[model samples]
Target: MKDFNLSYGHWDLYHKALKDEQRHDEKVQEAIKNNLAHLLSEESIIMTNGEGMARLPVRSMDEYKLRYGSNDSSQVGQGDGSSAVGDTIGKLPAQSQGKGEGAGDQPGVNYYEANVSLDDIEAHLFKDLELPFLEKKENGNEGEVEEFIYRDIRKSGVMGNLDKKRTLFSAMKRNTIKGTPGIYPITRDDLRFKTWEDVRKPESRAVVFALMDTSGSMGAFEKYIARSFFFWMKRFLETKYASVKIIYIAHHTQARVCDEEEFFSKGESGGTICSSVYEKALEMIEESYSPKLYNLYPVHFSDGDNLSSDNNKCVELVKKLTALSTLFSYGEINPYYRQSTLMKVYEQIKNEKNRFFIFKDKQDIYPALKHFFSVKEKATS
Candidate 1:
């Protein structure tokens, strides 16, 4: 008979058994391996003592090796979506005992176990990681929750030190009740003081979306800047908002969706129809997200060098997107030496309110992001 405790590490029992026996047992070794594999197969494995000590399972350690490497040095290090996939090994759900040991002299039943995969575990965990920091406050009348990205840091302060400081101050204050009677006139028993009030500050929630053209003319520099911009903006939005969902669309003759990895690394080399991207984004917003419910913002990064007569369609697309989103911005990453005709069409939109932005280089991204989230003077003051 084999005994196993989930609290202890897998190798712990194995090594102990081996040291005691001094001889190798092939069957026992195989059983241990199978036990570990079964543990790995379990989804949502949480450690009793919560911390980074949790085991995150990946499809296979071999898969991780292929993407990164077998060596610890080959870790993807740190980035926005680096730790996205993994298997989490932890405790099993509580089970209740059956009423009778044997079913009225009938045979006993053994329940079969279902093995879970790394992919299944990752998909399960991703839902929790989606904006874990922000707490939701339900809005009155509407079912929609008022989402804020702010954190209440004061709620987790050191109370022990605060108590000691308060006690010392109280004793000092009592000694001076009769007006600055210096020296240790106050007794420790007379010391009575209140605890410090916690501090909390309001944080802003702003979401900025970047739609970049990955076509050939943009060059390596442009692509790099675009990836960095998205990464930075994602980090910033995370601080202020309860959630941030980044959608990447690469359009040439038409627009199709891409994940973060494909969006940053994929290169461009096809005819341009800028309107296709806008249309798809509009559909996505309508299907998954509503304008008033979310802090909606859309930014399009493209070269001013679009097809000669497609400007009208582009303007129509802008109008459609602006209607759906809170603020729509067009950032033209002009790298080629061509006429800036793209700017002209967007400029004619009549309404100057949050419509277009044309930039010459990468340095403009910061300012452009600021402008995108920047409130008007009346709104700011």
Candidate 2:
């Protein structure tokens, strides 16, 4: 009899290649996160109905590879009959340098485009944002719906719920009883299927208020930007809440409730009175959605075209809304560098409960979302 032990020295060296690959993947993810502000508003990404890949420009890590020098002896290259290995084949065309110089003195940046699917981008972007401030309050109208949960096994059931493990065991038992000791011939009595019990579960309740400025001052571009913000926010919210109730509100000189179709496409021509929408949102919150029953999120988007007379009223109403909300956000879509009467007033209230953003162009859309829904803590719960 003999007892022995084996050992493999320096076994960790074999895993170096895998470690390098993991590091490269981490770098790619970091680059995507850094460039997400611009990538979020890109037309290609926004228009990808539900499936597609997004090409993101990321700087490649400087990799060192062994190669021969330009004047090395080992050379075998053919192009224009005067080229050798590691030498320029011909005059390389100038890259974006407008035909002025023979060649730029500075070195080129090492950038490579990485193709990531929509799901990947979503995973990266949303990982940093969360809905932690959502607190479960008392007096909930939490309705329960019937759901089928598989639990038991039965002989007579649908094919979709057939239990293979149980059926095989039954077949084996029948075979042993018949003195065959095999499970080849499975009978009707040996077949087993899974059964489900109907039960009720409580669903989450939340309300989202999407307010937009439809005044004459808000052109097609401003409205489009607002719509884009809501579109992504809605998708993000749907994943968090089970029953999400969205209240679409469009306001010019007055505020009115409308359907989803009219909320994004409807256009109005009138003066700007931003306080009207704020007041209307506050009224709706009190009349229907109680803060104790539903988590409240009222997001408002305008061009900062609020009238001077209504700025005072807007600030007062905003203070009240922020107090009764799970997450409150206000966005100002100002394309041109114009003076904003409302933005100036709203910035003074340094209440950390509410979030405010000013977007000049499409590139600012994603950043605005990150700012509005960004949680201070690390955990989403």
TM-score of each: 0.47, 0.68
Query: Which pairs clash in the backbone of model 1?
Result: 45-89, 45-90, 46-90, 56-87, 57-86, 57-87, 58-87, 149-240, 149-241, 216-268
| Worst 10 contiguous positions by lDDT, candidate 2 | 7-16
Query: Per-residue lDDT tens digits of candidate 1, residues 185-296?
Result: 5464644433344443433233345677776666766665566556545545554444456777888767888886787666868777777788888888788766644555
RMSD of candidates 1 onward, in order: 22.4, 11.2
What residue runs in model 1 are displaced by over 4 Å at the alpha carbon? 1-208, 335-338, 377-381
Q: What is the Å distance of residue 206 in model 2 from its true position?
A: 1.8
Local accuracy by lDDT, each model: 0.53, 0.77
CA shift at 49, candidate 2, in angstroms? 5.0
Report the lDDT tens digits of candidate 2 across residue range 142-217: 6455679998888899999889888989998888988988767988998899999999877657788999999999
lDDT accuracy of residue 308 in candidate 1: 63
